[model samples]
Target chain A: MTKHFVSDTLVLLGRSLRHISRSPDTIITTAIMPIAFMLLFVYVFGGAIRTGSDRYVNYLLPGILLITVASGISYTAFRLFLDMKGGIFERFQSMPVARSSVLWAHVLTSLVANLISLVLVVLVALGMGFRSGAGVAQWLAVAGIMMLFTLALTWLAVIPGLTAKSVDGASAFSYPLIFLPFVSSAFVPTESMPGPVRAFAENQPVTSIANTIRDLFAQQQVGGDIWIALAWCVGLLVVAYGAAMAVYHRRTG
Target chain B: MSTDPQMTAERVRGPVIQVRGLAKAYKELHVLRGVDVEVARGSIFALLGSNGAGKTTVVRILSTLLKPDAGTATVNGFDVATQAARVRESISLTGQFAAVDEILSGRENLVLVARLRHLRDPGGIADELLARFALTDAGTRRVSTYSGGMRRRLDIAMSLIGDPPVIFLDEPTTGLDPQARLEVWQAVRELARQGTTVLLTTQYLDEAEQLADRIAILHQGRIIANGTLPELKRLLPPAKVEYVEKQPTLEDVFLAIVGDDGTDSTAGAASPAGTKNRGTR
Candidate 1:
């Protein structure tokens, strides 16, 4: 059974990857929003903000990467919703293939697409004179955190993908996620906000995640923020995976 | 997946598919209630019904996509509920709509299914099916670019991969033109000739009259009538022989006017050189 699941996942993965390769606009569109924000923040709003950093892009890169993933996962939901709408989901369900492989294939495709989008955003950051003093280990840690966050959000996206009535409904869930980083330290320091807003901003998942990635890039002590970020990612992943699987089985069954 | 010894022994005898008092219901609507059916091996069995009847529900339950609320169904002598994997191994489902990857080419779609079925030489299988379905010319083109009929043909071609013993076609010709419908009927006939059990569901009575060896009329979640065409005809009074003029159906006139000879003519219409290609082919 496990063997069939593995092989089936690889086959379906190849199929969806072909979809991504053919219409590269999904990845480009995913990267576009974060790139726009990065440009807007660094050029238009950077000098005015007091982030205690010489380059605002460096401080902003982590949040921008998160937004890139946030935007990219909507395509995951969109693609899965298309499959469900197209009747292909029923086709695969009725076949001898491992059923879980269908959702896994879509989730993995989202991961790969998001990785490419993240790289594109990073390249744009580099071009805009964004510099990181971090070494290879720091880069790997950052990559790991981004991937965990991606998987968590990707699984979360699967819920709407399965249950959405329309294409727009499938992707609309990401708007709040894209808006999440704005309220946190992603843009400005939480200290600058008023009482309740600052409390909420500092307590949310994005704040610790952004601070961790930011400290890593700056070669500063990550402190307890890294632990908090990892805990949030792992916790969200578990909850989202459980919820998504429940929804998947209920919908497909 | 170990097969039950009793099921293996039973596989050599009786019907290829059997359903005993199958029942299913949504929250407030009962879709199928105590439905029973048996399809003989290698026979073309049609579940005839109009829209809102439970034809699709039966197909879904038998194909292991849905579990019946009550009763049992076995395909290839394996229970659909308990031995779903084995039942799945023995059947392929071509859904009401063409369940194809629009982004992928025709050949890619075939290869994808073949690979999913764990068949060897997926490329060879895809090419063979493409040729068989007369889709070789448009095999490399994306499915989104193909006409509706061509897409249906590709959809059936994909289902043919691995050549499972039983096939379920849920209104395969619902949205097709006359010529395309004929091509699908021909493909189905070829499958029956090769000893594949076909369980087809459709709203069209003539399709069942033309294709099925046995027909079962499902209405209000029950089989109101079940028999061969002649037997069903005998259920009513014998036909009175009266002289009447036979007129050609709109389908015949449409096919004649289009001059479609089961070729891939409609597929070309979507391409830039469609007209030129049609003339040459």
Candidate 2:
């Protein structure tokens, strides 16, 4: 069964990757929103917003990457919802293949697709005069954080994908995630916000993650914020994966 | 629709599927209650019912897609509840909807299933099924572009990969037009002829009448009637012969008007191969 799970997941992963490749629009749309936000923030809102950074795009890129993944995972939910509604999910379940391979395939596909969109967003950031002096290790750390954040969000998206009744409901959960960066240091310093809003923003997962990635890109001395970001990503991944599996078992059991 | 006597004797060899006191409920709604069914090997068994009669529930349970609340069911002698993996190894399900990947081409869908089943030479299996289903030309095209009949045919073709001894088709012809319906019926008949035990659910009485070796009527979550078509016919008053004009059904007129060649190009190529395959079996 374990062996079949590996092979079956690869087969189904190829199937969904084909879906993404055939319609490149899903990837473009995922990147488009973050790119537009980067442009608006760095060009439109950059002059007035004071983050003490030499280039505003440098500070803004981290939060924008998070938003890109937030938006990209909605497509993950959408694809899973389509499979559920179309009855293809059940078709796979009824077959001789390992059952868990069905969900794993979608989750891995989300990772691959989101990574591409993240790369696209980063490329756009570079074009917009965002430069990082970080060496290979720092860049690797940033990539690692982003991939962890993407995996955590993707598992969270799986809940709505399995349980939502409508396509709209499946994807609507991401709006708050996209909105989260706005309240954090993604746009401006949390110190600029009112007391209550600042408290919420500081305590949230996005602020720690964005701050850590930002520091990494600038090649600044590592601080405890790295631990917090890792904690947030790992914590959310565990909780979301547990909840998604619970929902999966409840529905298919 | 003649019953092959040799296959009938083969059926007596054993029941490929068996169920006893099966029951299932979704919260407040009781979908299936104490349902019992037995399907002979190498025969077509139709679970005949109207919508909301829990025919799908029964199929879901047998396929191990859903668990039953009570009693037991088995496929190929393996219990559905405990030996689900073994049961899955011997059975395939073509759901009410055409459960296919719309983004992938017809050939890709076939190959996907073959690979999932861990069969060697998935490409060969896909090509063979594509040719058998008359989908070779559309094999490279995405399924979303195919006509309803063509999609259903592809769906069934995917299920035939690895030739599992038992197959389940839930409402295989529910949404199809007359010509597509005939095409599906041909596919179902062909499966039984190849020594596959088939369990299909259908609301259409004529579908049961035309295809099943034995028909079980499920109504209000229970099996209300179960027998061969002739045996079930015996339950009613015998027909008294009287002179009456026989009028052609709308289906016949439709088929005649549409031309026996079939409006869909892939439709005309299936029958001859179907006959040839049946003869060899």
lDDT, each prediction: 0.88, 0.87
Q: How do the predictions measure up, each by TM-score?
A: 0.93, 0.93
> Which has the greatest DockQ?
2
DockQ-based CAPRI category assigned to the predicted complex of candidate 2: high
Q: Where is model 2 more than 4 Å wrong at Cα?
A: B1-13, B236-248, B261-281
Report the C-alpha displacement of residue B192, candidate 1, in angstroms: 0.3
Interface RMSD of every candidate? 0.9, 0.7
Model 1 C-alpha lDDT per residue in residues B126-226, reported as the tens digit of each score: 99888878899999999999998889989988888887888999999998876677668778887776678899999876678678999998999988899
lDDT of 1 by residue, A1-253 (tens): 4569999999999999999999999999999999999999999999899999888988899999999999999998999999999999999998988989999999999999999999999999999988998999999999999999999999999999999999999999999999999999999999999999999999999999999999999999889999999999999999999999999888867
Q: Write the per-residue lDDT of candidate 2 for residues B6-116, one digit (tens) a residue.
A: 654453455788899999988999989899889988899999888999999999999998999999998887899999998888789999999999999999999999999
Clashing pairs in 1: none
Error (Å) of candidate 1 at residue B149 is 1.2
Docking class of 1: medium
Prediction-by-prediction clash tally: 0, 0
